[model samples]
Target: MLVSNKLLVDNDCPMCKAYGACFTRFNLVDNNTISPYQKTNEAFVNDIDLDRAKNEIALHDTQTHQTLYGLDALIKITTHKSQLFKAIAEFMYPFLFRLYKLISFNRKVIYPSANTAVGRDCTPDFNLKYRLVYIILVALFTGVVLHEYSVSIYSFFGWESSWFLEIVVCVGQIIWQYVAVKAFRKKNNEALEYLGNMSTVSLIGGLLLSPVLIIQSFVVLPVLVLVGYFFVVVSLMLLEHIRRCKLKKFPTLLSASWVLYRMGVLVFILTIFI
Candidate 1:
């Protein structure tokens, strides 16, 4: 009972975006017609009567009243071109399905689902490359910003300091951050992933530090230091709690602790001479 070939897709998923092109290339559609599930009314979209569409790449056969999602839909779309591909797809489905579920899980975290029970197995998509690079860049950017604040404040107070050594120490701290994480977490499983995760959490926590530090230098506000410390602590605590609950044997706890100490140093001005 195959109905007319109208491939409805969750426009929100990057995987579906790729699959949509497959539909066009195979002449499955005469026009570009992938409906973003968020806007699409699911009542007309066959077997997925509820809105599980948001968490999965849904493809429905209106005639058969059958629906496929994630790896199933991908296999369906590719199976027609070659039996070999279908076989390969079948072989890969177990792993791909899990990966797909993981991506779906992260996506739902950002744009929740009407059906929360879906994608229960998907873990956090650490997004190692992008997150690692972002964390590195942010640290360097924050370093420069803090350097300027240091020079200004120290100069105003008639003190002398070697900024070159300070810069070297700051960069060293970032590098050792990775080492610390591996040291603290006993398992050493997914060390790079843990490092990336910790860096991501730390960066988010201190995102406001650079600007606030610069501002405080001019304004002489007493509470700004505490505010910065609060930001970093909230981020650290959030990550620590997440690790304890989700990744019990995870690495990077030591590195994260060191990062907390470094962030504290940033707020030390308010700590002393009070």
Candidate 2:
């Protein structure tokens, strides 16, 4: 349900202008009657407390007069997507709405609007240094796995399988990766750091597992490993670009793309084992 800015003209302010620009850019304005009260002919201007409007944006349900503010307003907007966003809004709305209200109220006293920066300002050196440790660890694990695979080829075929050792190495790698990520998060490394860590982990894992080519004899395994490695490298390069470009805030598009790439890696790994 797209709401039009024209419907709420009586209360138009700078906030409204910003919201209008965002809606227009997203092509979400489907109707000329944008205000929640416009179609219903309700006197929202008179009914709603002006004091509340000073601190919060209001969106009233036409049928119920139910007021939504902050994150509630965001969830309502996301509902129109009716796909991924909709599902996320549905699942996250209840908790997020309360959190938004709590933060919004506290922000009025603790952090004024004038002090808040529009976007994040994180340095490339800071991000790279933060992630370098994780990258080195992943590289080390990759080297070890590759070495193991190379040695396994010459060990009497089927006489003594190294499958148990492979499983142990995989589990150990996973544990180390998890610990590295946990530490990174605790340190509040920027999105670039997160992306770098993800890419390094995926690439290292894929390269190490490439020796699967010798034992599996499946044409798909090598292709999967190569594709995974390519994505990891590309993702890391894009993250580096994000820092250099000083693009819009942290959590850049590259970070999201890395997540999808990691998901693909997970699926490939599952397919290989199962």
Candidate 3:
């Protein structure tokens, strides 16, 4: 099952590293063929488009001396493994390709690398367009989840449920975090990365609510149960926010500010706006 090809991945990306290791461990690629473009010799690196490879992984054919990239390279390895796997890969090419691009484009911000090596770096260039896309999509999801949750619980707290309020709150979070980052006088890139991570936390909380949302579609749960679960999700989101903030070496007070914004917004919506 050993394919005679070298797969070059970003050593800094945990996803990429795990991908390469999985290929090697599963005998999908030859032993010692999974390499980091950063550490690979210039001769081997010169064999492929280094820039393109940085964005999408590169697979160099050791035997034919040819190169394939991104999903094509992945399909190539599967082609060597078995007809069934190869067929499945080709069948799901469209969805998988988009998913690959989404992950590839945001990999750095998804898990910012702390590696400051002096040698060649394989870190993908930060694409603001994709980063914004990620943020917007996450915001939309969060907004929808909040809108639905508010509808379910507003009556319990004697508060009016406004769909528009949920959307405003979601958008407000982005602005609030941006202001927080600016208050600390962070550089533009750092600010953008922090915003991306913050949006991811919101996204995580929304996803955690999804199952309960689905259940609510069929069964009306008690208000206290819904409220308690919401708080539980929020607690987890808070811990994750703290962990990611620490990962980026951001100030601990940033997490405090993050929680403060949500609390302030909740108070405003429940008391004044409603």
Q: Of the candidates shown, which would achieve the greatest lDDT relative to the real structure? A: 3
Candidate 3 per-residue lDDT, tens place, 1-274, comes to 6566688888778888887888888877778789877787676666788889988999987777789999898888767757898888889999889877877888877766677644567877788888888888889989999888768788776767777878888899899888889888558877888888888899889999999989989999999999899999999999999998888887788899989998998788767745
* lDDT per residue (tens digit) for residues 195-239 in model 1: 444544444444645566657667775444544565566666475
Q: Considering lDDT, where higher is better, how would the candidates rank from best to worst?
A: 3, 1, 2
Off by over 4 Å in 2: 4-17, 30-43, 61-67, 106-274
Candidate 2 worst ten-residue window by lDDT: 115-124
The global Cα lDDT (0 to 1) of model 2 is: 0.46
TM-scores of the candidates are 0.41, 0.30, 0.85
Which segments of model 3 are wrong by more than 4 Å?
25-27, 41-43, 78-98, 116-119, 158-160, 272-274
Measured on C-alpha atoms, candidate 1 has an lDDT of 0.54
- By TM-score, is 1 or 3 better? 3
Q: Rank the candidates by TM-score, best first.
A: 3, 1, 2
Q: Tell me the tens digit of each residue's lDDT in model 2 across 124-153.
A: 124243244444445456545544543434
True-vs-predicted CA distance for residue 81, candidate 1, Å? 38
